[model samples]
Target: MTYFILQFLNGLQIGAIYALVALGYTMVYGIIKLINFAHGEIMMTAAYFIYFFMTLLDLPYFLAVILAIVFSVVLGVLIERIAYRRLRNASRLSALITAIAVSLFLQTLYAILFTPDPRAFPLTASSFPVLEIGEITLSSWTLITIVVAVIVMILLQLFVTRHKAGKAMLVVSEDLKGAYLMGIKVDRIVSMTFAIGSALAAIAAALYIVSYPQITPYMGALPGIKAFIAAVLGGIGLIPGAMLGGFLLGLVETMTRAYIPSSVAQLSEGIVFVILILVLLLKPAGLLGKSEREKV
Candidate 1:
């Protein structure tokens, strides 16, 4: 039972990361109806930027994180302007293909520049502290990750609910045409959404590197895919739903790994796919998603 509890905590920590990344996917999709498949690469680029700053410039960790996030935000805005803006009126297939091409281009760039080798982030002394409660043991890093994730989520909720820009984002997401009709500056809102989401992904990447230490060009691929799945499972375009989906998926994955046989442990991902199919079959719009009604 203690082991189970510990595993649950671990799962929650991982879920928090997924939730952060998933938010990027959901928010972009919500506002622009674009999947932004290159989001993971944006995250990877941010991580690499931080690493370069730390190694080449000898910057502090916190400063590196901030700069990385800012860099990612700028990159996101640029991509939206240069790539997505052109395709806004084009077919959805065109936007999707462009996104995929961008994703591959970034991945290839990283592989060429970073050698596809796993690089270790500079680990501070605080990286590996352990904590114990009763019979359960947990890492300090895990606790920190969960706390940070919660705080970020709260800030995001508050922004979306209370801030003017955030309200604009909500309006755009709910009805882009209506928002445009209301003089909402739809293009600016979409750019802001991408910037905010990419910034979150950068933070998630930094935290992930803190926990795992070793990172490669492809490190973001699996996590990004899983986070996208979580967004879909929870209901794309719903912020709270994305969070719940990420945590639930994390718990399910962890539990499956813990209790299932070793031979079948490899199939945990498959299990998640099965669950996704079931969810889609039962609720095509997702757990918290509302059905879209077409105008006759």
Candidate 2:
């Protein structure tokens, strides 16, 4: 029981990271309906930017974070403007292929520039490094990650539902044509979505490397894919649903590793897909997603 509780807590931490990345996936999907497969590369690029700012220039952590986020936001907006904007009315396949191309381009570009080698990322530990409750131990990073994820999700929800820009985003997501007809700047809204989503991924990348400190050009690929799964599992276009899916997926992965046989423990990643399949079969719209009626 003690072991189980420990694993569960760890899972929550992992889920929090997934929630951050998954929120990006859901947000972009909600607006404009593109998956932005290149998002992971955006995060990767931010990580490198942070690293460069910290090491090469020896800047303060706070400044480095801000600059890294700015760089990521600019890159995201540029990708939308340069690669995806024109394809808005084209087939989904075109957008998908473009996203893939963007992903490969970044991966290769960074690999060539940075040599594809994994670099060590430095992280500061919490003031209270460990928390103990009757035999279960939790690290500060684990606790912080969960708390941050929750706070970020709450803020995001408020931004979407209450803020003026948020309403514009919702309007655009609901009906781009209607939003345009209503005098809302649909292009700006879409750009804002990409920028915000990319910035969130940068934050996630920062939190993620603390747990797994190795940084590489391809680092964001796995987390990005997992987060995409999480978004789908939680109902792709729903904000709260993304959070729920991330936490649930985290619990599933952690629990599976703890209980499954050691020899096949590697299959834990595969199990997430199995859960996804089941969810699709049972509720195609996702756990919190509602079915939408489209004109034929």
Candidate 3:
């Protein structure tokens, strides 16, 4: 029971990270209809920024975190402006290729500057006091992560449903042309989407380092991919769907690794892919997604 509880906590922590990244994927896809494949690289860049600020600049942890997030937001905006904006009216294939190119460019740049070696970041003490519940012990960090994720989700929900800017974003997502005609600044909204997504990725990266300090240029790829999968599983353009998908994916993956045989564990990724395919075939719009019917 204790072991089970521990694994559950671990899954929750990982799910929190996935939710953060997946939200980025879902949001961008919702408004722009682009995957933003380079998003993982944005996360990698943020992690590296945190590393540099903490180790080289010797900044305090909070300051480093803030700076890293700021840098990531700027980078995301620049990527959208330089690569995506130009391709806005272009074919989806062209935009996808651009996204892939951006991903490759960032990876290459990081490799050159940070080297291919995995560097470990400094882990500060866990944020929460440990609590013992019968045979199960829960760490403060895990609780904090879950709580924070929930709070963020609530705030985001309110923003989208109630806030003017968020409603504008929704309008843009629903009908870009109509929204533009209605005096909504489509470009600014799209940029805001990128900024928010990147900021979330930064937060995820920072929290991830707390548990797993090792940082590498390619580290973001797997998590980013998984988060993308989560977005799809939950209903790609839906914000709440992304969060639900992330936690479910995390829980499923962690449980499989814990109980399944080592051979099966090795094939867990493949299983996830299969699940993704099945989900697509069964419900193209995803679990919570609504199918957008085209009007002639």
lDDT of all the models against the reference?
Answer: 0.89, 0.89, 0.89
In terms of lDDT, which candidate is strongest?
Answer: 3
Off by over 4 Å in 1: 124-126
Q: Which lDDT tens digits does candidate 3 get at residues 130-242? A: 87879877777787777877787788889889999999999998889999999999999999999989999998898887777889988888899999999999999999999
**Reference-based TM-score, model 3:** 0.95
State every prediction's TM-score relative to the real structure. 0.96, 0.96, 0.95
For candidate 2, the per-residue lDDT at 216 reads 98
Greater TM-score among 1 and 2 belongs to 1
Model 2: worst 10 consecutive residues (lDDT sum): 121-130
Structural RMSD, model 3 = 1.6
In model 2, the Cα lDDT at residue 15 comes to: 94
Top candidate (TM-score) = 1
In candidate 1, the residue pairs with backbone N, CA or C atoms under 3 Å apart (3 or more residues apart, or in different chains) clash, namely: none
Instruction: Give the C-alpha lDDT of model 2.
Output: 0.89
Worst 10 residues of 1 by lDDT: 123-132
- Arrange candidates by TM-score, highest first: which order? 1, 2, 3
